[model samples]
Target: MDLRLAVYHAAREGKLRLLQKLLGGRSAAERGEATSGAGAGVGPPLLIAARHGHRAVVDYLLEQCGARVGEGGPVSFDGETIEGAPPLWAASAAGHLPVVRTLLEHGACVNQTTRTNSTPLRAACFDGHLDVVRYLVGECGADLEVANRHGHTCLMIACYKGHADIARYLLARGADVGRRSLKGNTALHDCAESGSLEILKLLLDAQARMEKDGYGMTPLLAASVTGHTNIVEYLVEGALQQEEDEEEDEPAAEGKKDPSTAGLSSSSSSGQPQVYCTREAAVEALELLGATFVDKKRDLLGALKHWRRAMALRHQGGHDLAKPEPQQLVLAYDYSREVSSMEELDSLVTDPDEMRMQALLIRERILGPSHPDTSYYIRYRGAVYADSGNFERCINLWKYALEMQQGNLEPLSPMTASSFLSFAELFSYVLQDRSKGTLATQLGFSDLMGVLGKGVREVERALLHRKDPIADSVQFTKALAIILHLVFLLEKVECSPEQEHLKRQTIYRLLKCNPRGKNGFTPLHMAVDKETTTVGRYPVGKFPSLHVVNLLLECGADPDSRDYDNNTPLHVAARNNCPLVMSALMEAGAHMDATNAFKQTAYELLDEKFLPKAMMQPFNYVTLQCLAARALDRHKIPYKGFIPEELEAFIELH
Candidate 1:
């Protein structure tokens, strides 16, 4: 190994002699790089030693080598680096109690934080380091409520990670239980979501109140969504008992009612208002949980059981419980409805597929399409179909999800980009010859052409309102390559005049928008370049095709359009060794002797093997008009104001 890396290894392995030897006679830049932990993926020597519990190396570096005690560096734990973490935090998080004690003894601050403001106390609580936690909080005067930048306290982390003993210690140390994070999630919500029933009881015993998150999700609903049956059952029982207690404690005074129960109950035959209404919220939670079991867990029987319980609770005790209605009809679900009676819920057992569809419908209705889980389960169900060789059904569902993403998500969103990439990969798969035995349906012109048209529309929509994005963005380049491949696929299919016209019309729209990607490569430029073939994981399309090039030229693509390197389409074709495409561009009025930024012509850029087999020669390209333009430019003759604009532009092209 190199001496710089050897120093880090010695420090990490606690080899004080090797580290002492490597520490002497280093260059200024190398020493600076080591001390700052800013070298190529290596932390400081003291940080590495402290993280691995090398107390001798730590003491030597700090005392003998004068290493900075509070110097922050990148330290890793469990395969993820926490940038700007002090040595004390790293040692505490790793449970190296000896290193932790040494660092603190050397005057390392107990409340020092990472880049995200996660304190050392919070770090110790995260991994259940009880001794480190005790030292940091009990002896060193660490603040119990010093949360991270997201407002997550030490108590919250302990509860979420199921460290019940650590949580008890924090509770006794005056850690706040009701403090919420930036997303409005408390300790109760975290324990509920993680299914830590022991921690859940601890927080409940501490009187942690039930509250909704930023997405309006209660702790009960969060438990149901994660499919924690034990926690959900326990919380549901508690909710019922609490409702009973509140009802019994209600006063019997005339014309006076509890504030939460006023105007809540529906009228009965007795004309006396019933105030026991906690079952309404419980029924909704169970119904939503049933949807989770169906889509997230793939448990049809379990989903039916939860929905049956929800329906039973909805009707029992004469409460006014009802499932919410959809604001608009969903064509993807075939206009599904919630089953009103227990018989309807039981009838779902006969047809498992219908029950699956109902799960999707209920999730979308409750979560709404804007929420990520709504589209997630939709695409997930589609993928399941693709895995079972039912690709036609898969394509239909994926198309619905794709359109839904386009409508709801912002332009150029990753989810939308992923949907487009999925279509490209799917089209490439079913068109392969090996898929012929399993796929019953044929890949059609309409299927490929339809997505291509939508893809173009999505690009147009992005450009309609905002300024055009930089073409070098990764997302933009991926989109451009995918669009070019889609056009390449359209060439293999046989289309009538109108279909072909529509195809040309779609290409026309894209060309009119004049979008570029990755070093200003236009559609025509990408069609003739070889690098576009590596845009996807699988083989989507080969570039430099004569057919794709000719179609782009016929549909308003500029023949001599230049990229960012000042290389025109002919220049790109020459680099790719596409003789046919170069000839087509030359025939379409491309300048044969035009120079790029490298001052090399298309004929000069061609490889030597192709030079002997070249279709167009130097003698054929040389003309008196081109010679006159070059001579004028070489001798500095100025004729710009004297000539017409088009003639002057042509002279400059040389």
Candidate 2:
């Protein structure tokens, strides 16, 4: 009854004969008319036929039924207009050779460009359909040289993707051997990039020019860099033959530069004699492909040290800045292999703690005491100790590592300072200002606050001496943590009137130096939120206490500064279900309508889950003010919008 459903079923069922009979009887002019879907009449029928690979039905519809193809059309199912693709493209992509042939035979443009500017041939090539490629190229005479929207020719794509059969077919059909893309990439460049020897040989036999790409890299040179030996060898042999042939042609031109040889040599920017311009001449590529070499231990170690130095210099600039010479890559490869053997030792020890200890022993044996490597193992051992909950031993081992790191100039670099910050923070928070009998404590690391304070002073002095910004940040953060811990310790020391006064002084000093400090919490933020932090050994006393909040605000701390989520310090106080702290904030002019990142205002966020109904009495004044402001500011729909429904009750309360 519905022509759209009948057409849809006929296309999907591949009822070609039925489709031809029903649609063919109509006049060509009327048959071309698109039948809209019965429901919303949004999409047409031909797109559904094409998209589902009902090519026989597609051919009948387009050639006989006269269905519209490409650009602006529709699907009956979802009303999605077909975007720039013809039925032949669908046929070619689905590898329906018979349907493709039929459609092409009926003046369906074979080289038709779709929305993406992809031709039928490009679609067939991308799908790796050999029969379809042959049909599009041989039968339909589709242009193989036509570039896609990306300017990639069919042959270049096939070659680059390692579709050897398609590549050979394009080559045999006289595809442009020397054709270059918009980025100056030849067909051979694609083969080199893919590292496919079969595709490389096919292009080479087609006499693809041996030329440099956009990066001044010849196809063979690029292949070599990626370590493709077979491609390298074949090109090398071809190049040698070409060289001999050229020399024979120019026997009498004494001292006259041969054009081919001159072009090859002058192609590179470095001006190195490009003798090994052939694919086979990539010795580094060949060696990387599978070459092995023996090295004397002395030479190996020396090379390792030298390459490491060069690698460090490269780090300071970039990998390209300190471009390793050919010898350097070769030597570094071997030296890197020696270093890799150390990783094997890592696998032999199953337990990480034991392995870390063994790694330390290896570092001590190989690098000697007082070396950077030795100090690294000592710090690693400290980490293992810390992770195992031996906080005392962690403190001991880290102190030893710090002492050794300080003694060695290389060990005491900014890198070491960065590493110590993590250990320092863990010690302050976890170890509870407890002095472990270590070299650091023996050298008067009696008070953690004193040692941390000295670290701050040293970092400041060192900052002046070296102008190291990275070192300054790391050291300053570590020092600020110590002061926070100092404030924390004062809060814990038996709460008295004197202790309260002392706590105020300590927090104010922290706020002065590190205003918007570590962990996104100022000392004031920490003081207010200390109830949430679960570090047991050292806490800023039992939290949610009114005095801690009162003293903090009294010491000139801003109660309005928000956390990352835009929750003001008062919002944190409320969400913690602390009515006393809430009362203090409300008394101190804390805004109640302040919304967090979630768009939930402090009044809206108050829940029975966290805050009971009894908690509402304390929050009544601030909530009422917020509601009254919203009610007073309400306007018409065109002007603004109606007030949020949740605010109505609070507005009534106000």
Report clashes for each candidate as comma-separated counts.
Answer: 0, 7
User: What are the per-residue Cα lDDT tens digits for candidate 1 across 537-634?
Assistant: 78888888788888889998998788877788999998888878888888787787877777777888888775553566655656888888778777
The lDDT of each candidate is 0.79, 0.55
Give model 1's TM-score versus the native structure: 0.83
Segments in model 2 whose C-alpha atoms lie over 4 Å from true places: 1-10, 13-48, 51-53, 63-66, 71-85, 105-107, 138-141, 172-174, 182-184, 194-198, 225-227, 238-281, 287-629, 635-654
Output the lDDT of residue 462, model 1: 75
TM-score of each: 0.83, 0.44
Pairs of colliding residues, candidate 2: 44-74, 84-115, 232-279, 232-280, 235-279, 236-279, 236-280
- List, residue by residue over 117-233, the lDDT tens digit for candidate 2: 777898788778999998788877899888876678999888887889999999999899898877677889889878898887677667677776654556865664444546766
Give me the candidate number with maximum TM-score: 1
